[model samples]
Target: MQMGIVRRSVGALLAVIVLLGAVPVGAAEKSAPRHSAQAIGKAERAMQEITAQAARETATAEMQDTRISSVMLHWTPYPAAVRYAVRVLRGSVGAPMKTIATMEYVYTTGLHLPLMAYGAVDDLYWTVQPLGYDGTPLAAASEPCPVREAEADPAAPALTTEYAAMPYAPLYPVYSWVPLAGQKEHEVEVYRREVGHDRYVHTLRGGEYDVYDDTPFTVPGTYVYRVRGVTAAGMPISNWSAYGSFTVAERTPIAALGDSITHGGGAITVPPSYQLYDWESYCTVPVKNLGRSGDTTEAMLERFERDVLPFAPRVLIIMGGVNDYRVGIYGAETVRNLAALREKCRAHGITPIFLTATPIRPALMTARMTINTPPSDWWAHRDYVNNWVMQQEHSIDVATVLSDADGELEEGYTTDGLHPDLTGKKYIGQTVDSYLRTHFAYASAEAERRVRMLKNMEKTS
Candidate 1:
């Protein structure tokens, strides 16, 4: 990990060359500004309210005063906003925020969101990021709008860990947990809740915050895990939290492979930091970011076997093609390269998850470099690759969310249209997270439950 990171300095140098050396395509006509002065002023005021220092979470015997039934994230409506995506946070304003779900529509100035069986009452923070007519985010996200859960629980019981992925294990399955209050030591029970079986497999004792169950899982099928707290005397304390599931196969980490986008980069420099954005910082699953700036599909392939195969990840999210298209590489060649990557993963028994290339804002692209006589129809090429990707299994449709109706990056999501800002990057990360939460659920019971809930929300929304 320490490598470029020194290499990041090297990548930074390469990135500047890519930005300046490359010319943007797709010339456009200017119209009404995407944002107006009035809207910006209102947003500024809303930011002040949302980002204001949060008061200390006062401890109360009742705790009920802090419980909130609903959370509403609000912001000033921008003239260009056709839809708004709201992210809700439950802790401090400045700390990393967990994006629960993205609302599909912007009915009014604000959206009232539901919680995940949130029984605790205290603090919640939200940010509203507007979207263009196309799915692209429209403007800067509203500062973390703080909300309080106005309900109380009987007790502030010790909760479980917010583990990322719970993949299968033949060696030792690692489980992460939060420490239970009032207990210096706690017991954790790991259950083997797979199909055709229902029982506690292991009641681990005196383990660290993260318990690694070394027991060999001889069973070769999908395993769902649920952990519950216990006293040193093997007494139960809190109820079991949500189940974390992973299959028992070639237990490997998940790999995110791509170019600068995968490397977490935003276009433009001088003031904005060039350091790669840590997309996994908020992910629910533990994923290795193997993204490098200025890597085309060919460059990615050159290093694939060496960097990725070593981990033998359970799933590999392969998102490439944009960098290939940047240099006017034929769409077919890019597709061929991606197909090769997919085949390699399949050959190694790795699950392949592909993502469509994100959209580019033409205005930003044009301003970045000299418009060279490149491929006349870059849009067609992009669509061709995206169409092919959509036909495959385990495909992540991020391009749809980032593109405007005109097939360009939504102005709000990018400063240069080729790369995403924090607002855009967060949206992409959360969207991938939503997909993973559903896909990794080997147990259909939990999977179906979430799908049904999303459908209901869609109907009501």
Candidate 2:
């Protein structure tokens, strides 16, 4: 019945909007092979963009009594849209990003996705894309919007921090704590260890604050941290919590930024790629996993700054294109995306480590008739992408490493036809870990990290 409601609403909306033209762009803008535009005045294209800009999309979470039950996204009615497709993306907007829900447009209102879809996640991010009849995308997607809980958490609040550079606060490493419930003040413990090999040991007592802006870190090495609630009497109120690792003097770390394969997609165990504990979890070197499932090269590039570059790692591990191949992206175009990524990494002095796309079973590709690359031509396309990957000095030959006799995914390495199983992830992790040890030396500096990142900004007036 609910599904039928969506269909009826979409059908009614489409009937009315059959004549409207020009919609905003989304991820499709970066890599859509060709766009079929209705003949609208040049002003219409520009007007649509301005209207979308003038109309800010809003997000609010639903409260089931005291608990959050869902997140609702609201946008101004686009008279031209026959229907809208809402995409609920996860923490980051890169490869392996999942599409949690797809909803039809209701013009003047908001739509929601169940809170459970987020799976213990808070503050989910998303964007809305306009669609025509037959599910053809009508316009570019809107800018991403984040949904945060307006209600309070009754439980002892969980905490996480993000590292940001402050020109004003030069002496201290800035750890901006995420807002928490039931506490105005918080305590933090900061510690340093070997880059990747050792465990994070609590080494220092720090102040309770909305941010960790005081206390000089003084040391020049990789560091990990934990935070907890503090009582008014200057006592501990909660257990120290763990988030992903942070850096102090990150020894020229390398980050793997790709889709599901790099993200440890399918079933994950022992450790996830997110905690920087997946296959890349060895040798005392940190490999930040910036992977999001279902990300194309173009989408990964769009999120380069927010997800990949902020850590200022000296190297980047890149593996993408399978998602693009599904959309029938041409080999030359896909290579173009990788080449652009390489150039960006170079400008930032971050060496690019290219990885070949893992091969998938022909049967799987065939069964998914919707995919642009069919079984007959998929192998050839993979070879083409792999050939390009091999041209790079730091390339890891994963396609060969994970290919079976029939040239699909290797028998024991995958959870399914396309994604890697635990064994397969280990194999990739081993290859990446070994390569990093042999290639890059133990050397990094603040200047080295900043030099390339600064050049990324275009000189705008």
Candidate 3:
């Protein structure tokens, strides 16, 4: 039976060729007699049907093995390389997909590379998942597969901007912009202003990015920065992003503390007690202003035990004496008042930060009748007080000039001539805040307790 079946199949093939008139046509007729027109049409239709069935079967098999997804990389300046584990598709009938391999990766400046598992052809399905190198869990599902055709993976772009040098121990702010569709949970970048230069310094690649409260940038100078997203396909999205510029504060925190320009009038905020907003969007740390609109060093001394000392602040910023100058308190008396305040803070283990009085704007001082004290006298007394404060090395962290002998708010940072308006407040607050955040690592609860206890102690003192 098998021999007969094989012979029949061979015969069918031979018949198909002969029926198509492969031989030459009759000489006189100029054409050979083709198979009956009906027979030829029938055979042609049958062949088309068979070919269509085969194509459908092949398509079904291919479709069964195909799956879509993508991958993305976050670039940082940290020297360590990023690692990820891929959970591959697994199982024949009842099996489950599981992690099969891990990979090491590097980030280009603001660039993300998209990758594909080479083995996952149309014959097999795959899904790529991201995992921390050591399984510490940096991110999971950082990228997607079969990226959208119309829109490129938002992460495909590379970032570019001008260059600046980094400082010896620069602290950079980290940033990441992964959207909702990304598989990864968080991306981060660090940036800082360059010290002594008019530009920003940053590490090209950050090793690992944290999800919350990325580090604050401490580099100085003014410069621009740019960042972009990258998909895993290793395709570069050639687009430059906008730049964020910042100026490194010329005066250090100690300088700010001692500089009279940092002093504010009326209920000024104090340190160790941050007044962060409820939304946590802006600065809201408790600060003991101790800055009465017309208070002098003498007044501050009277209020120190009641107001300032109780906070038990790790750092104490003291800006006073303009009022003292107006009241004929200068030279020796001014020095004595400041010295007393210093002793009070130190007795409670607080580091006193002092600032020289900012210069009174000569033009504005004459224009605004609000000036009660002579600018010349105020300036002289300020000089004397600063000289005296500077002499106390242990009690004073810093005692420096805010402006020249003549007061002038640095270009855009000040709103008024004497008192710091909103902008000045923010600028001053940031400087003070930076110092406290760095030096005093104590928690809010502890800080608050210290403040409360100190205040109580003062009642008995």
Candidate 4:
């Protein structure tokens, strides 16, 4: 019976070979049948089914591995720590542990490691070291703690903008939040708090991580905003983030406008959201911060009409040009942009206060941020811009206080060589405060006069 079965299999194979040999090679090629659209569609659907099955299998495996591999590390917050350093280790049963990864700057107290990061390791541990503002170790490294897995859940967006203190909100407040994974879109809703209920004021949708609300809030009332993530199909993916509330007065008395320096924040990892890093926070005079991070002179000028007009500030402190000169933009062009900003302020009856651009320390900048290589003649351009600033009617020489004898940013005053740290910010804020204290009447008179004239125009219209 086995011999008979083998003979039959051989005979079938020979028949197939003979049948294939009978067809002329070129004829088979020429007569090949074209697939119908339906057939192609079926093939594509089948491929998609296979791909989706593979993805599902991969997701299931990942979920299982995540049960044992994902880790959320938390430690008591150290008093002097501006940031923390986290080190991950791997080890075997008998061998000693070896360092696998080191995160030099962690802004928050808790760090989450996903499955993909350490799924392959059977034994993993981590340690946290507190670091001061100057990157000095504030405390000894914590004992290595064994990584334990916890169930992972999708997180809602975390709001970054805050208006908790008095003199509540900026005119053109930037609403920003940390984005969530797999978030395709975001929905934002603004509500004005009324006597008995919250009234809906605005609703907007965008794909970006932040929305700069161009509409000026002129009313003296409290407003709240909440944001949530949405899927591409318009389905909600996350619950609404906690409402960020702010109160708006009739108008801001003084406002600062420029690039990152004016926006606040230093020590590299810390963001402008922290009041400690904001120069405005150190100033005795109440000044609203209208500054946005990463704004070039051109960008600042472009946003002046939309961002500044809303606040209707009496005095606008302008400190920019660092972002320009460092990127090799011609000094004359920056001056032109600044001049345009000045003209716009004057046209709108606002006092334009110019602040001299600070110098950069290329060596420290390179060490901390390799991508920020300033041009060889960056200082010359800075000098040119500062010279232009000094010629303006109202100017503050912040650069003079922050610069060393060699014209570079004083090493002690800065962390990244570009942005002035707390000490430098304090000096700048104090200088501005002193100047304002002496000239408050003049700035206020001019601003008030403009407000009256605009109101008169409105009545006539």
- Write the residue-wise lDDT of candidate 3 on 336-455 in tens digits: 887887787778776776655444444544453455546456667767876776666532222232364334534232223444433445545665555555655463234445435544
Number of backbone collisions per candidate: 16, 21, 57, 0
Q: Give the alpha carbon lDDT tens digit for every residue of 1-461 in model 1.
A: 33413454445445544653353432111312553454446555544443331111122312435345554343443543545676655677657767654555543344445554544424566677867645687577877755663222212122232222211122234454433333334455556554467567666664423344545443434445655556677776656644655443322356678876776534342111112233544455555556666678887777777667765677888888887776688889888888999888889888888989877765667776454433557778788899989989989888887888888788877756577766667776787777777887442233344334433533453
Candidate number that wins on lDDT, 1 or 4: 4
| Best-to-worst ranking by TM-score | 4, 2, 1, 3
After superposition, the stretches of candidate 3 with alpha carbons farther than 4 Å from their true spots are 1-286, 309-314, 326-328, 373-375, 393-416, 443-461
Measured by TM-score, the strongest candidate is 4
Give stretches of model 4 more than 4 Å off: 1-82, 85-105, 109-129, 132-135, 139-162, 166-221, 226-239, 370-372, 441-461
lDDT of 2 by residue, 42-151 (tens): 34565555444333221111222335555445554332244578777666545455667656542212353456556554546667876542456767778666655422
The worst-scoring run of ten residues by lDDT in candidate 2 lies at 162-171
Clashing pairs in 4: none
- CA displacement after TM-score superposition, residue 422 of candidate 4 (Å): 1.2
For candidate 3, the per-residue lDDT at 67 reads 33
TM-scores for all candidates? 0.42, 0.42, 0.34, 0.60
lDDT of 2 at 400: 82
Candidates sorted by lDDT, best first = 4, 1, 2, 3
